[model samples]
Target chain A: MIDWIESVLHITVQMGTLYLLASLGEIYAERSGILNLGLEGMMIMGAALSFIFTLAYGHFAAIIISIAAGILMSLVLAVMAIHMRLNQVVAGLAITMLGLGLSGFLAFPDIRKNILLSLNPALPEQALMTQEAPKLPEISIPLLSNIPIIGRAFFHHNVLVYVSYIAALVMWFILFKTRIGLSLRSVGEDPATADSLGVNVFLVRYLATVISGGFAGLAGAYLFIGFHPFWQEGMTAGKGFIALALVILSTWNPLRAVLGAYLFGGIDTVQYRLQLFGLGAQSPYFLAMLPYLITIITLILISFENLRKRIGVPKSLGIPYSREQD
Target chain B: MSRKINTPFGVIRIERRAAYPRHIAVLTTLLAVLLAFLAVAIILVLIGIDFTAAFTLIVESFTKPELMLNSVKQAIPICLSALGLGIAFKMNFWNIGAEGQIYVGMIASTGVVLLHAYYGLFDEHVLLPLMFLTSFALGGLWCLLPAFLKAKMNVNEILTTLMLNYVAILLVDYLIHGPWRDPGGYGFPLSIKFPDYAKLLFLFGDTAYTGLLMAILGAAAAYLIMDHSKLGFEIKVVGQNLNVARYSGIDVSKVIMFGAFIAGGLAGIGGLSIVSGIIGRLRPRASPGYGYTAIIVAALAGLNPWLIVLASIFFGGLLTAGDVLQASMNIPKTVIQMMQAIIFLFILMGEVFKRYRIVFEGKSGGDMP
Candidate 1:
């Protein structure tokens, strides 16, 4: 029973990191009043780029290149939503479609051949997409790893997992405890006022969005190298959207995001363990539906006007910021 | 109102337009499409594919009669789905769940077929209409919760509708893989094939006459509601300004609910057309993002029902072209999707031109037009 509990908790933390990293960045973006609906696109692109680069170069190069790819993709959104002042919703959707299509196009066997051929020329071309990379090494902390079930579940993991823990803490601190965080929050809440106070609304929004893209990229890389380590088409499969929901559930708080992501991760992990609990007869499809269904339910629960107000939902989210209009 | 920017040699002014001529908007859209095609060609060239050969194949897809007919068949569902989305978007409701609604429609219509297959209850004459009504109702109901939440609680319809889409898809997957699995043939995840009585009547070898007629009728009905009805005016008013709508005594909630229902029902009909008319029965991965593609179609058409027909056929041809490109050149069909996205982005950018005019003035005071 103890062993079962530890493993479940272990899988939960492992899976939760995907949401944790993605949502943390989104929290920053939303805190700066930009609703980027293209996280999925960025994430998937990150995964595809990382997988290819991993095959070509090493893991470090793959991670950096993926982050660059994500930043590049988000730049499209920043230009549209922040610079061009297009409707953020439509622009985000366009970015998503672009990412989805571009990633898929780049992942094609022939396209991969030409790409890898150009990159190295000496590497094997056959079975490129199916090729695996060296997984991120797991480092267990000596004293922490020996504590209890929680120790192994929490402390013993890959470097990215630990990076997520530090990332969340640092993000939470940067968002609430610093002047930069104040400027970001103020910009999201009221860009006009923030601009009046000499905050560079455009610059802050651009950075936040790019950072969000970077985290989404890291999440995607973690999804490939840290979690599944495979290149199946459409594998990310709405996980990006789930991370979006986690942003709201966390109420734009990076600290709260930790709990929300893990909770969702627990829900996801529980689907696999349903069989172990003598509920093996339940269809895996229905179990798969839980996270999405719960997201809707969460949206409904938090949608009460009073709750939204009290929770301090960013006021200018999804609205374009224009200095000329101001 | 205008905003002026000082460049090194001149002053550039961007002035808001009260209105632009219709022809200019049309021209801009056409230019955007041309540019999108050109952009795709460039991408293909960079990847070492022969752009001219690929372009020739795509043009051939449009010229061939049978392929044209297939494009028309593809147009029907896209047309229906876009029409439904047009209604919702007009009311400023982002019901992106048409994909899910399509799945539910398939499920409901397939349920009717399963019932008939098991109990032999309904005759051939009643079967099609029965499937039609059930699918519409279920599809409408699928969107109702999000609509209700958006209306009453002010929830984000985009997220709710999107989430439901996955739920509806998973529900279909469960049904096909579990209860509705075809018991006779193989272990494949598929429902039983529809009988002759359950299948839609086709005019050509593969194309459905009913689907075309339904799309036409659906557009006509949508046109009547949008242009002639009081509800249409209410929807327009509500979308333009909620405060104005409320001040003018429009039942905002009722209008939103009604519009969402119609929108969902139309997408549901699109789903039915795909399942009953195209494929024979329900299956997993039935929709190839028809719901999402409809968003582009509706937006391209400027939410005009009549224009949606033209846009759908145009996009449907592109989809066919994508299949051809995939088969002949070993290119992924998502290349077409990339083209569509670029087109959408360009069109979105073009909206700036429609709304604002840029005038260049030289510092020397000689370049004003």
Candidate 2:
């Protein structure tokens, strides 16, 4: 029972942290009125770059470089969707296809060979048996570690998990409680109105996209060096897209984004556990599809009319705003 | 006071600016294609390849008999899908789920073939038509979901359609890996080889020419329907503006549903063609991303059914050349994808410029620089 509990906790932490990182970036972009559907493509590019660079250099430097590459690639999307006033959704889709193609081409050789370099286990002093998977270092809070459930969930996690939580909190605060957030929201709500009020709408959209790209890149890096420590073709899978949907499901709220991520992470973890318990051979495939299926159902349930009245999506989301139009 | 401007005509003179006719859209498309080619050439040069040699290699692949046949064979499915897509786009309905519909068609066709084989129904002459009908019905039904959701529930078709593609893929994956796995095959993730009676026979000797003929028929039929029919007029109206369409007493929902059904049905035929004519067995990667590629073809062709036929052939040739480039020049197959992306960007940008002119206002007297 204790072992099972430990494994569940481990899976939840890893998946939740990865998703939180990606979805938070997505939250910012969508909140700014640019539906960056290219998140999946961006994440894939990040994964491939980080994996390749980590194999060449060390993990930390690869993380930094991958983030930079992601930001650079996102600028291409911004140039077309923001500056040129092209359709945001199509531009995002094109960016995804471009990223997927480029990454597949560059990473084909590595993927075919399955040449994954394993990370060394941290803390040689620990007496527990080391598994093949590299163990992330955990920080135990002095007094909080003694508490029962909440203590294990919050206090004892890898540095990435803590960083992701802090990032989400900081993002929530900045987006809701700050003057810049107000301006960004105004731009999203009514770009022409914002522009009339002297807000640089174009600049804000571009910045939001780049920062979103940065976060997506960090998520990709976390997937490789931080989570799995391996490389595979189409490694990011559809997680990036799910993150985009989560942004909507969360109603662009960073806190809800975390909750949504954990919910999905929990579903993913339970699916694996069900497979381990031998539900059926096809159970895993069905489980793999749960999150996407839930997203579709949730999307249908969350009608645009309801969202418009209450949660209120960006008025100009996915529509390219031209200053000259008004 | 009005002033008369002199013209090339002997006596009659008029001050006039040339009107931008609808045909200018075609010219803009051509210019976009040219720009895309130039961009591809520059990228080739940056990647340390001789652009002339690479392009020549691509062009030469089209002349070989086998490669030429392959190009047509590949174009057949894409052309059919594009026909449906063109109709939908003309009606301004973005039916992006052709990929999923195609998968559904493949599954339905495979199921029919399997059932026939199990029951010894392949010995009968009616098996082929039965398989085709089943596939088309399945494909059409798959499309009905999103169409219903969009027309009724007002859900975004793009996201729903895309998500459905993943679901269809997974469903197929489960079947191929589990129940549909051929007992005779030793651990191969493929179904049994389909019987000859269940297959689509070639019109010519040992070629997928029958599929090509069907595609041509489909394109021609779509052209006739879209151009000569009242239904086509309603589609055009609905696509241009739904409120206008409603005001004109056209049932907008029915038009959308009809368009989607036809689109999904055509994609279904494409799937059936693939299983019966090419692979002859079900596999996980049954499609080579043809459904998505059809979007590019349809857009590049300006959503005209007849033009889609020509565009599909061009894209088919590109796919053939991409394979050749992969084999001989050691270029990644993704270069073709990159070219497609570049073309889409250029075409979209060209459309923007064609619609709207940008004028720079000078604050002071300065040269045109």
Candidate 3:
């Protein structure tokens, strides 16, 4: 029983760590009113770059390259949606397409020629499971790791997992306590209003977006180096989208984003755990669907009166800023 | 108000035009698309492929009859899906669930196909009608929940629609992998092969022109209805200004529900087109992101039904050429997909030109005229 419980908790933390990083990044972007749906693309590019660079250099270089890739992709979105003043949703969708395609092209440079391995049958496959990637060594906390199941799950993890937790806490603190956070929030709330009040809405938005890119990149790198240590084209899969959903579920709170990420992460891991417990063998697909199904239900419930009251969305969440527009 | 602005070369005056000429906007869009293509060409060159070979592969996709036919066949599903989704978009409804709608439509059509295989229920005439009806109805039902919520509860349809998409796709994946898996396929995740009578009739080489015609007809119908009908005008009004639409006594809720239903219903037909029309069997990973690409097609065409047909065909050709490039040049399929996305980005970026015009002038310079 202890083993089963410990395993579930360990997997949950691992999955949750990824979601937390991605959602933390998304929280920053959303708070500043930039919805870059290209997150999956950013994550994918980060994963591929991290994988390649890990082999070329090391984990540190991989993380940096992944972050750079994220920033670059976000800059593209900023140019189109921010500077060009195009439709945010359309621009985001396009960026996502570009990100997914380019990353896939780069990652699987010769996969098509090899007939034996499965093609990225998964839309956006990123699991280069065949190749070797050096995994980040786990760092067990001294006294904390000696504790119980909680210690193993929380304290014993790679550098990325601990950093992701710190990042989430830092995001929470910076967003809630800092003047910059207030400025960013105001811009997301009403850019025109913020601009009228002498805030450089453009600068704040750009910074927030780039910050988002960094976290997303770190998440991707962590996904490859810390968790899987191999790459696939679409391996980030729907995690990016799930993180987007988490942003909403958190109701724009970075702390709540952490909670939401872990919650969803637990839901994602539990299904596989069910399969391990021999319950999912008969209908693993049905069991596999638990997470997505839960997201739908949560979305519906969030739309209800009580939850809706709690959820505070940015006023100009998706609108591109234009000086001329009323 | 005319304003003087500083420039690197010289000071310039800026003024907002009341409106730009339609022809000018068209020219700007064309120019943007051309520039975007040039940029992709540069991208190709940087990726170690010669620009000429890439250009040749694209040209070959259109020049070859077989490739062109394949393009049209692939285009049918995207066009149909885009046209359907375009209606909701016209009302500013984010119906991103077209992917799920299309998947379920396929599943429903496959269900009908299986019926014919097992029970021998009715003739092809009746079965085909059943297939179309079931597919459309199921797809509509799938989206109705979100639409109803958006209208009544004032819920965000974007989240609901997108989440439903995952649910629908996972359900399809489940079916193909387990209960629906064909025993004779040697562990491949695919449903039983559809019977001949259940398949869509072909008007081309081993492919169905039925879907392509349906897509064109659907577009025409959408064009007529969106431009000419009262419902379309109401949708436009609601999309442009919801409060104003409500003040005009347009029964905004009904419009939302109806628009979503029709949109989902049309996407359902698109799903049926591929399953019954092209693939002729249910399989895992059957769709190559047709529903997602449908959004680009719809957006690129400015949500105009007729133009969506063109955009869909263009995208379809890119897909075919992508396959060809993969086979001949060893290029990844993603390169073509990236090209499609770049075009989408360009179209979106060009939107500013539709509403605003750019003027280049030196310091202290007056209008050209």
Candidate 4:
């Protein structure tokens, strides 16, 4: 039973980091009043771009390129939602569609071959679909990793997982304990007030949005290189959207995001465990529905007015702010 | 939102217009569309695709009769869903759950067919209509939950609706893989082939006129309801200014629920059209993101019912052309998605021009601020 629990926890931590990275980024964006629905797009682009670069230049270059792609995708959203003052919902959706399509198109076998050739003429022409890159090396913390099950589940993992731990902690500090955090919270809570208080609403929003994209990109890189090392069309699957929901479950708090992400990750990790438990014979697909269904329930629970107030739902979220309007 | 551009010579100032003429709106929209195409072409060129060849293939989708039929078939569901979404959008409701609504619609209609086979619940003549009604109701009901939450509790509809889409899809997957799985069909992840009575009649070869007919009627209904009725006026007024609508004694929650129901129902019928009218039976992944594509179609059409038909057809052709391009040029059909996103981005940029006028002030002289 202990062994089973350790294994589940191991997988949960591995999967949970994906959500943690994404939700942390999203928490920042939402805190600055821009709800980016394009996390899936940006993440997938990261996965796809990283896979290509991982094949050509190795993991370091792949990570950088993936981050750049994410930043580029989010920049498009920033321009649409902030500069053009378009509906943030539509802009985010468009960015997601663009991401999905672009990633799929770029990863097509022939396109992948062509891209690889462009990167290195000496490289043999091959489809990326059939290839796998070396997984990120696991870094077991010496003292912490000595602690049996918890150590194996949390401490003995790839560098990306540790980065996520640091990222979440740093983000939590930045969001709640700093002047910049105050600026972001003020902008999201009341941009007009923030603007009058001499906050550069556009610049703050632009930076927050872009930073979210960077985090999303890093999440994608971790998803591809840290978790699954293979190149599949939609390996990220609905993880990006799930991460979006995680943001709400965490109530847009980075610290809470770790708990929320791991909880969902535990749910995700239990798909096989349920099979071993014999419930899979009757309802494996139903189990697949758990995470999403729970997300809806969470949304409902969070939406209660008093609960929302306690949770600190951003007041100006999804509303575009223009200086001239006020 | 700086409306001023600092230049070496002068500062260009942008100011909002009180109102724009219809001609300006039309012109700007056309310009946006053109820019979208140009951008798509440029992207294609950069990706080493023969732009002219791809363009020719896309154009052929319109000129070729057989391909046109495919486009029309594809357009039917998109048109129906977009027309439905137009109702909700007009009231400023972001009902992105059309995708989930579409899935539930498919599930409901599929349920009717399976149940009919098991128990002979109704006569053959009533089967199609029953499928239509059940799918619409289920789809609408699926949408109503989010609307109710949004209306009553101020829940964010976007995430709830989107999350439900995955649940509905998983339900479909479960049904197909388990209870509804075709027993004699070699353990395939599909239900039994829908009976002859359950299928829509085809007009030419595999092309069904039923879908087209339904799309037209749906557009007309949406047109009349949105442009003619008191409900339509209330919805518009509510969307324009919720405070004013409340002051004028409009039942805001009721309008939201009703509009959402209509939107979901239409999207549901779109799903029904796909299973019954096009594919002839339910299967895994029946929708290739038509619910999402419908958002682009509706927005591109400016939420006008009649224009949705044209926009849907245009997108339907693009979708068909993507497949053709994939088959012939080894180009992924997702290029169409890229183009759609570009078009949407350009249209969004055009919205700025429509609402504001930019004037280049002579040189950065004194009193510019």
The candidate, 1 or 3, that scores higher on lDDT is: 1
- Alpha-carbon RMSD, candidate 3: 4.5
Q: Please report the candidate that would top DockQ against the real structure.
A: 1
Error of 2 at A218 (Å): 2.3
lDDT of 4 by residue, B1-369 (tens): 337777887888887787877777788778877888898888778778799998899899889999988898899889988998999999988989888899999998999998898787888889988999998999899889999999998878888888888988888888887888878879888887888778766444354466777788899999899889988999899889999999999999999999899999999999988888778788878998999999998988889999998899999999999989999988889888888877777777778888888888868577454
Candidate number achieving the greatest lDDT relative to the actual structure: 1
In model 1 chain A, where is the ten-residue run with the lowest total lDDT? A125-134
Which order, best to worst by TM-score?
A: 4, 1, 3, 2
The lowest-lDDT stretch of 10 consecutive residues in candidate 2 chain B is: B9-18
Q: Per-residue lDDT for A1-326 in model 2, tens only?
A: 76577668667767878888888877777777888878887888887777666655556776787788778868887887886677676677777776776676556552212223223333232212211223345777778855665567667766777789899999999999999888888878888889899999889988889988898888888887777765566778778877876787787889998888888787788888887888787777787777768778866876668656587677777767874432
Candidates, ranked, lDDT: 1, 4, 3, 2
- What DockQ values do the models have? 0.72, 0.30, 0.48, 0.69
Per residue, candidate 3 scores C-alpha lDDT tens digits across A1-326 of: 99778878898889988888988988989889898787877888788778767765678998999999899888888887788777667677777788788777766656321321232233223333346578999999899987887889889999998888888888889988999888998999999889999999999889988888888888889889989976677788778888888887778888887778778778878777767777745366665555566666666676677665557567678888877644
lDDT of 1: 0.87
Could you give the fnat of all candidates in order? Answer: 0.75, 0.38, 0.66, 0.78
How much is A267 displaced in model 3, in angstroms?
2.2
Tens-place lDDT per residue, model 1, A225-281, is 888887766668889999998998889999999999999899889887885675754
Per-residue accuracy of model 4 over A1-326 as CA lDDT, tens digit each: 78887889999999999999888988999999999999998999999888888888889999999888888889999998988888988888888888888888888888787788788777654534456777889988999987877978899899889999999999999989999999999999999999999999999999999988998898899988899988787677778999998888888999999999999888878876787787756476777777777778888888777888888999999899976753
Error of 1 at B200 (Å): 2.5
**What is the Cα-based lDDT of residue B139 in candidate 3?**
90
- In angstroms, give how far residue B152 of model 4 lies from its true place: 1.0
- Give the clashing pairs for model 1: none
